[model samples]
Target: MTDTNRTCFMKGQGAQPRRDRSQLPPRKMATLIIVLTMLFFLAAAHNAAAQPQKPQPERPLVFVPGILGSRLVDDNGTVIWGDRNSYLNFPKLEIAPSGPVTALHSDGRLVESINVLGPFWTIHQYDTLLHYLHSLGYIDNETLFVFAYDWRLSNFETAKQLQTFVDDPKRGRLQNGQFDLLSHSMGGIVSKLWMVKEGGAARVHKAIYMGTPFQGSMNAFETLSDGWGDFTNFIAGGLPTVRRVALSFPALYELLPTYDKCCRLGSPEKYTPLDVLDVATWRQRDWLPSEYRANGPRGAAFERGLSEARRVGELMRQPIPGVAQVMIAGDYFDTGLYLYVPTNRQSWRDWNFRRSKGDGTVPVWSAANNFSSIEGTEPSFQQHATIFADKYLQNKLERELLNTAPPPVKHDVLGEIDTPKHEKRRLDLARADLSPRIAEPGANATVTVAFEFETGVTRGDVQPTAQLLQRGAADAPITLVETTTDADLAVRRLTFAGSLVAPAVEDTYRIDINVAGQGDHAVFLTVLSAGRRQP
Candidate 1:
């Protein structure tokens, strides 16, 4: 049977049983009807408030996260991958195989694994995207959903799954049998496969791609051949995880540089059609033992993986006729070129890494589809990792997804000049009025905290709140206060104040300040106090 036929058969086998509404009694049925009606209206009102005042109904949004973005956990709730601690301690921990690309559930409700962490810090994947959409009044599940799949699988399989998700009768199908897609990096490849091979053009209204390597990334080839490098390994915690990721995942092989379309290093020369196995053998001579040269299991796997990748790449080059495509490519950073110099045995470097412009991972030419569809490309200075977090990109995505009017076709380099600097929000204690470092019981003190935003960022409508709590009792709030924004200077400041009262017993008290909205800032304060004043 054909792949599409096999996919349909598999979907049929896994189809979930629908709820039997007819089983309810007459009185229960009447109550259910009333409850459902009330819920429907309440949800409608909530959506109305969240979305812009446009005549069109809110279209459903399906977000596809990039590589290492989805949380992988076992049946017992133990994380398998995508968690910093788990990944770092991968050898020590009982690493469980990711069962399948499936949805996570908690109490019978869908649980989203939208973001993952690097070795030392959190690497936000789609959290910023989702938060921005939510701030614009997009309701979760009702109007927004995430497609979290195993990044190890082929794009073809993932594309098939996306097809099933969009066509599912019970919980799929947004408004008017169409939806908007926002894809980042590798997710864009998956989206392209779905649109081209799985007939997603009929269902997708607008497809927005951010920092997508449509042609493929030379970095993938480098990482698989040489090593993940110090920076990437440090970010991923160690080389083991990177090695496992590079060798195990078929998807990464799909991201190999499309040589035929890419330019050679140090010049604007394009390469001839190159075989995947030949390139792999040339690059990984030392890594791949001499015995397993061309006909070994490793070589066979590479051949198989490359074969599938080539098939997907061929299909991806074809444009979806009905769906509107928006390609957002990043520029400014030095990108890897198609050229690679083999310095010595098992040693190579990208030829034009110091001069080529890209998003630091994907070269600009590759990100722009080698200028094949340059008329639709939107270039920005933001790096591949930060493109989705960019407010400009967010605004553009909103306009394309929500507005009724068709987005204008403009081939221009945007946000390249006077590029906005991205920074993390910070909260700090500005002032405090405590006569004595150690206050007696019932003694009162006032504390003030300040939240500062980066130059380009503006504070959202949701304000910050300050709460005072005792150690070991974070659930209870001793005192609480809200913040007021001061946007007088280039750097906006949000100040929060609260009064703290000492308890009857002698102990240390903690003050916590939290801001709402995406990239929220938080601050904590510890204060020591004696027993209440002697009566």
Candidate 2:
């Protein structure tokens, strides 16, 4: 599973019913077919009515949501994390600056899954998906259920709780011991871990993952690396305080990018891909929580968190026997598929983004098991936040839920999944260079970029702009400067460049020459300590 190649053993399927019409005339055959279809449907209705299971023909459903999807509460049932006015309050989750780095708590438990944020702003989270399912005839607590767990804990704990919740006779345990699972984002990983690691496959019949990061996501890495500046996912809003609050969640680490060849070292034009999961990589980059780097229990806990992330990542790619899996991904928007990481192994900071097709969160390839299998949603330009509410995707979802759609066929066992080849397509990085790479924090640096476009993308669709964005999990990404792009015919490449004051901290930063509708090129600049030289 860690390698994304677990073979699922299919159980014997029940024989299909057959009917013969050759014995009747054409007119009678048509009449008989209609009559028989009506009778068959009536019988199904009757059985469903008489059955002890929920009155609907639909099987029981367990709905799990991604991290921050659930509301958190502490002792005395006081609201902790899921405040509707969280933007202003920024309810703190205490992570001692340095200590044992134990999973923080206050008699913590899941109060409910998050549905909306910024009550005044009326933002939506799971409300759209939940209401859509309700319209499709999923009854809450009867035919449908939501599993809410403290997202701060490891997925192992969450998965174990899932096993307990599903098997509990008073709750989700159905008469036939079967249910369909609908999970969004991080919940997909949680559900997968339970089905594969905790042996919940015996009960789950079908699992639909919507915008789930089965392979992992760059957004998660970005959020962890820099506090959440992802506006699409308002949970990680661009505020220094909010960024610090999100750093303590173990679930965030679990969501780190695990796909193959996800990142490269050095400048975008001259870089080499590296195995991003290697601990040494994180160590060398100083990506681990700096608070723990001084040597303490918290440091050990941080390493443990990474280890758990690798474990969950491996288990996520594994298949559960008898459990069918379908991934619904949004594939239209330019997503940051891979990154150009700074070669400065001195300290970890930013993941300079290079976009391709994705849900604006999880890349299409990442959602489709790194293109190891096909996904149900393809070429749909829907954003990740509103994907479940998309009408086209809703129809596909209804078909999948009723088992009416044909199961996705995997690529030839010995052959690879037909890659959405980028060799001759996609925005290509031609050249990106940075000058005066040496700077102390808070100094200015200049950048120049040259890029070519082979994709059919046009400027009308993406208003190409260049920005020097802030990095790290403890501050919002404030644009230091915003610039525009133009054609540099002399160089035969599209060019955009800008300069801005370096972050007023000693660390590695980047200069991004972003081309809208095309792609971006990132060149790193290490702002050294008072005296340290760039390696």
Backbone clashes under 3 angstroms, per model: 3, 5
Tens digits of lDDT, candidate 2, 407-508 = 343222110111234223333334455666657777777775544444433222222344554444442232323232343333323444556666665544
Candidate 1 clashing pairs, residues 3+ apart or interchain: 50-137, 441-531, 441-532
Per the 3 Å backbone cut-off, how many clashing residue pairs does candidate 1 have?
3
Can you give the lDDT of residue 37 in candidate 1? 100
lDDT of 1 at 152: 65
Best candidate according to TM-score: 2
TM-scores of the candidates in the order shown: 0.58, 0.62
> Which parts of model 1 have CA positions greater than 4 angstroms off?
1-57, 89-120, 225-241, 261-284, 287-297, 343-355, 404-535
Which structure among the candidates has the greatest lDDT?
2
In candidate 2, residue 524 scores what lDDT?
Answer: 53
| Candidate 2: residue 520 lDDT (0-100) | 35
